[model samples]
Target: MRKAIVRVADLRQQVYDNLKERITRGEFPMDHKFQEISLAEELGVSRTPVREALALLVRDRILVQAVRGFRFPEFGPEEIVEITEIRLRLEPYAVRLAVEVLSAEKRTALAGLIRGEIARHGEADTWVAAHRRVRAALFAPVRNKRLIEAIAHYEDTIHFMRVNTLQDARWRGLSVGGSAKLADAIEAGDAGAAEAAQATLLGLARDSFLAWSAENA
Candidate 1:
């Protein structure tokens, strides 16, 4: 019975991860309703796990409950600006703190990830994953779990937008370049340079997102 329960929990976590990936990759249109039955059928899982996964997503603010069902949360221009502003404010400080405490082994690992991103180039998913690794490493030094989680939550909230921007070849090039610069700064153990590099990267992302939103609008 204990083994069975653990298996069920694992299945539910798998469902949650799959659903979150789809949502982040823009597989679901904005405000598209998520049906537990349909998702369960699609994943070949029981409705119980699907329902649990949806509840978890809702808790993460990735999905919203409507009268009809759960739907992807919709954000407009103002929300984008607000999210970017918050990221800009929090991330640089996180970088500063991380610089003070990053171990040489971790720094090397992060630099390798950035190099991998550059090599991956036009592959959107791989590039994004690599970029996330670097970001996660940079934030690893922050002692406040809540602050780190908040930054992660905000990043997840903007995942679709970020992925969309990354699809552009030009933008991807710029991102790789920025990542290289940031990696260099981190390796040098220069907090000021690392902070500046973080700002540059975030600024590029913010400007690209605003432009993309406007063009799509």
Candidate 2:
């Protein structure tokens, strides 16, 4: 079946989404230079909406404004490590809560995501996809909009670090054991164990990011 063509408004949203994804994924790289007119031209859009999108990104702390133009923000090792620490504290609670409220189907899906992680070990794209899947599972039960927004904000920061650190071989294997451990805990229906496993997983991820931060520093 052929896919429907995207409308102009949808295309604008897509452009903004693509730009955000690239920036967060490090496709644009830290401190990569970009301009309103040029980026709009490249994305086949008007400068007005591109400017609007960029303005929102700057508000989101995903981009920084320079004297010349806009660039991806450069974070220090300390900043990234602290963000990981936040994830360590909050994300486990999210998963534990999810296990209580998640449907049988979602539980199955979460387990499947863990299996995917095991299967995709060492593949570059697998790392990101696996992380995303786990996060969706964790938050699937959450209904609080404000809390969700806050977590999403934190995730943006985390995604930035993940993308930045992906080039390191050490970071590649950091979550391998942790993923399986958390999945086991969740499958066993042990909330405390799930939280503990999630914490351990978060610590492993934190340590990896710290190592990357040190190297980059």
Best by lDDT: 1
Provide the TM-score for each candidate, comma-separated.
0.83, 0.83
The candidate that wins on TM-score is: 2
Ten-residue region with minimum lDDT total, candidate 1: 1-10
TM-score of 2: 0.83
- lDDT per residue for candidate 1 within 57-132, as digits (tens), equals 9899888888877987778878887888898888888887887778777767766766766776535556665666
Candidate 1 colliding pairs, count: 0
lDDT string for model 2 (83-182, tens) is 8777777777877787777766777777777767668754565576557666666676777666667778887756666665554556656666677777
Model 2, position 67: C-alpha lDDT score: 88
**Per-structure clash totals for the candidates:** 0, 0
